[model samples]
Target: MEETITPTRIFSRWRWLYRLILIGTVVLSSVIPVYAQSEPLRIHPALLTLAEESPNEIIRVIVQQNAQERISGGTLSRAGAQVTRELPIINGVVLELPARKVIDLARARGVRWITVDAPVIPAATPGSSCNMLTNPGFENGMTQWDDWENTLDKQISGHAHTGAFAVRLGQPSGAFSQSLQSATAGGTYTASGMFQRQSSNVRMSVGIDFFDSNWNEIDEVYTEIPPSDNYVPVSIAGVAPAGTVHMSIWVWKDPGGSLYLDDLRLHSSSMDSGACAGYPATAGYNVLANGDFEAGTTDWWLNNSSLQVTSTAYNGTKAIHLGQAAGSIAQSAGIALPGTLYTARGTFHRPIGAPWSGMGIDFFDVNWNEISDVYVTIPETSSYAPVTVSGIAPPGTVHMSVWIHKNSGSELYIDDVSLVGDEVPDAFVQSTGTNQLWHDAQPRTGQGITVAVVDSGIADHPDLNIAGSNNSRVLVSEDLTNSADKLKDAYGHGTHVAGIIGGNGSASNGIHRGIAPGVNLINMRISDGKGMTYASDLITGLQWLYEHQAQYNIRVVNISLNSTVPESYHTSPIAAAVELLWFKGMTVVVSAGNNGNGNGAVPLFSPANDPFVITVGATDDRGTGSLDDDVVATFSAYGTTIEGFAKPDLVAPGRNIVSLSAGNNATVTKEHPSHKVGSQYFRMSGTSMSAPVVSGVVALLLQDEPNLTPDQVKYR
Candidate 1:
């Protein structure tokens, strides 16, 4: 006999599954180390199978200790015979010791694991011997530049004498100097560069500062620069004093507006020097080392527990796969000078979004204090797209960090990250036409209409609240994960999805306002934070929504989550349940899933693939408001379902979308700093974020004409 299992029966099965997970957590917590909690032990598996075949006499390794125990100096006392050198402790002291001792160190007290610290061999620097000044071209940003006085602004720009970048000094007063460590006493040197006057009232000059054997400044000379937008070639000759021991070159501008400098060269007066090709003439080199990930995880440091090398690369043979947004595969870019403009580039992909995920480069000052950080979102894609973050590094900046971070629980793959001097942001979405379409509609903002969110639970965000009251517009929340837990969001997806529907943007000063800000919300949560959910739980949530639809004025239902079972509307219970809700006087909208955007023939997710429901796909709005730039989101599932219907009723903006955050402990808030829209707003992606947008619009339509049937709503 054909049978049916009601929502109550599914609840009983869920209780058992929850109990098993709870029991497993209690059992594992005692065995795992604290660092493992942040990231797992990354011990190269070959270490346990060590043999004499290993080359190299000495190898570098990082030893991590347990949380409570400190790694004392005597921890590796047995390895004294094999120890060659000791570097400063970062994760731990980088030790150059025999590879044979690795197994022995693994058994040492408090040692969690030993990781091979392979050194990154950078691309050779040409013209090293010919150039007397360290960082003469401003290639390493400010690696060798002196900025202790801190009177003026120093930054990197794309305008160069011959290359793609140059250093610019702005405002009041300050100086940038490169020290020539080695110079024969009494020797003559010539300093030449591309210079430009950019609004500074006072003249900018280049000169040399001579120091005697005792480190006292004994002599100084200067050369003046004329005002110009284009680069003006200038040079100055200086002779080391009789008692001079060392010298430093300086490019200075007095209090005024700005002076730009680039392609600087300091050489013995006898040899002639000129600007190299314009693209990279200043540094004439890429400062970011090993950016292609060709050497495995050699130069990249793991933030989460996993090694990053993957087969999904944009250019090279390998890439980095990331899980947690908390930690990232990070590497230091060449030194970045304060106030210099920098451009970052990379490619990222995630089939199932959390695309609030992004890669970023952070600028740090000479004192190692953070000056500024910039990030660019990685849209959900089966392939990849370019991401860029370009801005002027804040004052006192001397270095930068390039890392990849995104929404936690969302898997991300990154490849070919490089930070150069300058910026051109690839637009994430459009801003025009969207406002006009909604504002010009009848009934305005879905005022009295209510939407039922039958997926994840929404959080109590300040902007999502019903104006003055402490309660949120998200009403009647129920956590299907556990009866013991409150109807609140612990895993982060639902809050962001709901925020996109009716968030008021109170916290973000209206910068991230939702589609239907006036619509009421009823959160019926079924999924966990990472968005993992079962079909039974979803069916139950839908059934419960049916029972309580009258208690709340739920005119629209949004299901951004999906199931893989591709049964027809005639055979699928979930499809029948949603259709019943539609007939009961509510419009249902669902996500087409991420599988659609790939090149292969993608099948629609169940229920969404059903002909009746409004299955929404995603579109890349190109960070603009006009429809001219819009294209279907690469990850939104499309094509015909097994039910023989071409689905995805429509497309909506889903790339780099910003909305309200779910407070401090929320997943997206903690893991994806790159997606932070403001103190209270966040950015995310996917058809999951797209579906609610349609639901909100449906709410507005329903408000305009209250008695519209499901067929009428679909037709509209």
Candidate 2:
């Protein structure tokens, strides 16, 4: 107690310690950065990607309970967004909001930001798209796929080569394939699939099937899938047919077989996804499981139950030998899509020349409709010849019947059989204006959506790079006009519009191109050669497009016309039709008119004046790529219509745009001879050009956001 009474001495010592602590605090504060202490943005990672890639793009979003009210009040209502979906569960709403407003929604009251409605797949490799196969890895366990008729032995198990599960083909299985609806014919492609088998008794193979427009087999190539302890890989490289429209993958396993397959991938050299990056070649399967007939006639069925599965090998350990007169054997093929090409090849051995009436393969549809004039045969001879059946698959063909006619007691042998297919190639580097915008934007190229071009007509060209037997041009065509065929482009304007929207630039060495190069096109010819279009013809065309939108996966329609007489969309038939399309979940893009902006007076026209559609105006991007000096085109119409709604929902480049040319186009030839870029391309201007550019961007938007409504597209 007596020592504590010395207060002045203790205070002096405590002051020194306090001064030292203050100095240390100042020193530490100077070393640390303010950002290091700040909290990170509390947004989903994928949502953040939205901000970076497609800021103006509107998308669906899910929120927490009671968050709809706050989100709509704070973000949707303020931004004039329309709700795509409003779910009562968890009080959720799938709304299409501008990508920029995502953060605002995150900050709103009572708004707990759940993730995006769909998984935001990261942008793919700059030039490559995502895998196009459905149920590719058997993860969904036999969904969206078809197997052999003898499917009783196939098993879906967890022993996957890649993914959660794979289908195991055990003892008595034929080819397993899914119809490739979107395959591009004439494109170079590579295919690889994994297989696993611990035993040596089973035979495995892989192959590529070439199919024509009628699903007929054009040509085929087969390779063996090797065996492995875990999983082996097999692959084939080839070019698809110019007439081939689609294809199918065939996985075959020999009778009494046991193998597992997973991670089947088809890499397209045309789309620039050709690299296999350490793809396995050993222990992989082939296109034909028992192409050599070494598997003892397990997959080959006896039509008459009189054929012998003999060990009389023809370049193999086993072959099929006829046991009785008129005896036959056949094997079923994998189901193929319409317009695919395939080929069947085998060696027929005949030790004794017999009077066999017929020995060839027959094609049939799923309904068992046998096709005529599409088979290969061996004539009466003791010597053998390599027989081949190569032709376009007839329409509705699902199976190929290969059989031998054992006439006059002919002892025949068949061995070393195989089939393969492939696709054509397309070069994107020929496309001009394909710059950082596409690279930095969301990774999609209007792959799934289709655009309807309502104009004069569309012509087929290499620039279009269309898929299938059609060569990527004109999937569907309607000649609403009386002057020409569905594929005729009398005025050339329609072809120019189509080229700007989806030209892959096969003709221009990749110079002139469209926005969504991979998107499909539907041509609705509604005008005459002199560029004359009537309201009746236009309406009829629009009606046809609307009725068959589902058939073509039509998500967008492009109208580059104008109406001189202004009327409210509420009363106009054409405008009403546009509204119907919008309501039916399609984005209708119309030109904002090239009527000189009506001097800011009567600037609106027909369908473009409608409030529900996406009206596009034109901006001159100069001769350069930068937008720094961009200005609204003098001829691009803009202003409030009589209905009291201002328009030009979006603006895009329209000046001096180079696109596909309808050869010998009267209007183009007379008006713009000097603007030609190449044999297939010509330059044009106006809101007509701008409208298609916007339509293309809409396709890209729909690629990743397919659920977006027309109002959503307009708002975006």
Candidate 3:
């Protein structure tokens, strides 16, 4: 190593070995081993480093089936070679040394070079891909930033090839299209995006266009976008063209303006679907406890004394218990009271042993005196029948007891005991009219006449019996209350009214016969004696009479009770309905109330002030003379509306008009002996006693001419 040698001799001795060693180093540096690493693969940085380090190295790329294509560009210059070229890298294939490798070899020969990963491809689905065709770089050869339009152009140019195309426009207009790799046929398609206009004064129309393979326009739809800060969802559904086609979004300006489009999507049809089916029935409760007496096991019988408790199968073949004992048994139980009248009703099954045995229920006052009694006698043959007893109670708490007295060992069954009282009729005993109408008119049977009786209720008194004729045709009968039972009177007002209208001279051993014994009677009970009825209820009663006018041969409706206008009257639906009834041909008679003269106080209340109704005033039965008989009663209200109209059309006899009361052949003593007529009658006063007098006259007129309208009847 210390020996000196010539430069020529040393170069000749080691040149070949040195050349082989350098080649080996280059080859080793260029080659790289394929190995899995924890780090994620990044192709751009790795490829750039390799290009810079070993210029002569052969570069290859391997990709998945759907991997993106890439492009690389570089410049090279050597003593004997100079090259500048850009090459495309196709994905999904292994590539050997390509034509661009020449630049790497040139760089190995000591040429200056520059390389770049070019042609940035946009991310896309396999069926649809994108690539940049060209890059203009910058305008004016300056590297300054561009506006939104130029930026968009750059982004579009970066991914314009391979069936994916984009473009930028300062303004959107007409229709635009781009080719698609594949198309759908007879499938639902949807496209959506956001569109905005720059000028507040301008409107923009955005739409999607579909084209066939031949570039023929197939379908298009347009939606409007206002020039405001709002993102509108514009979508369309239709069948896609067959084979490869194009889809485009376009916007047209009404007045040239700027517009924006973003967040675009497209989809197709999926599958058919449905939901569960069938109609379901509504559910409700049977309501077992709907006010059926089901408390204690005493069989709903209250025994206040020693008595024998027994059960009987009667109405509906249901068992009803009866408590029977001898010495004046008295007991009470809670019962339903409706409209002031107490009615005890039950069905009796035939006795098992003795037939002549009678079973009776006694209704007692608080002092334990019998007020009303219902009794039934069983025949030898076992039979089922109904027994009913109805009368007035003492208004408050009282006692009711059922009993059976056995002349022999006989059994009786009772069922369906019902008690109802509230708004019961006031007890009105009929006074026989002294002077009768001497007009030679055939006794009217009340077929064509309607006589509205404003009172408590009417009883089936024989002399005042205007219910059914000998031909069995009931002239009129209906409960004015909102209930079904029509035969019971709570306070005897009906019996008195009927007597005044048509009592047939039969009651309490012959005392009172009505004014017109031939007139048909309509028992319009408007009071329960304790208080006045609500205006709404009274209006309902009047409307009912009007509705049944033709059916019941009714021509007039009499409302003798009075009440202040309800708060609901000014806008009452019931009052409006009543007005409609009056308009449609019917005369309404209303009482001019009992309130006397007062400032700003009108005599008549509604149906009376109801404009078209015939308002009646009351007069005492004093004079048998001419117009002097028309003087209003002292208690009667004088008519003059707040707006001023002469009311109280005419006066009729209302004071001490004798009528009938409910009683059998026995004569009963009067509570006020001075008011008693002979032995079987009593006298009372009030407009309640006057209404039927006019109702009777109307009945007489109807009997004379059957076709009289209520107006005509009123005039007569």
lDDT of 3 by residue, 1-716 (tens): 64543323333343343223221111212112211232122232223334343344443332111112222222122212222211111111223343234333322311111112111110001111011001112111111222322222111211111111222224433332223444444445555544445567666665556777776778776667666554444555556644327655444554355554433444443211100000000111111111122222243333323333332334222343333332222225323121234444445564556435454555666676666665655344366666555554444325655543334233444444443332211111112222234233544444445565544555565564444434311355555554333444544445655676666555444335565665566666644432234433444456556557677666555555543321112222223334444544555565555443222343454444544566665564332222322335555556566435666676565544456653332111122334345443445444545566666666665666766655575676
Q: Cα deviation in Å at residue 434, candidate 3?
A: 12
CA shift of 706, model 3, Å: 3.3
Better of 1 and 2 by lDDT: 1
Candidate 3 lDDT score at position 415:
45
RMSD in order of candidates? 27.5, 26.0, 44.8
TM-score of each: 0.43, 0.39, 0.34
lDDT score at residue 333, model 2, on the 0-100 scale:
53
Off by over 4 Å in 1: 1-434, 437-443, 468-471, 483-487
lDDT of each: 0.62, 0.61, 0.41
TM-score of 1: 0.43
Error of 3 at 470 (Å): 7.8
Candidates 2 and 3, the one with greater lDDT: 2
lDDT string, candidate 1, 1-716, tens digits: 83454433433333333223211111113211233333332243333322122322455454533434545556465554233333211113445555555544544555544544321110011122235554565534556787749776665543444322357687868778877655555568878777888764687888888887666898888898888878788889888776777888888888887887876778774332111100001121234667877567787777776445787778645777776554667788645655556777887776655647777778887776777788877777766777787778787777788877765676777777777663112122123233344557353677788898876578778877776767777667777777334538765667777777888767766666777777888888776654455544565677677778788888899887765333344434456567667767778998877544244556664667778899987776544344553667555668877546777888876655666666666655666555555567655666776788888778777877888977899888
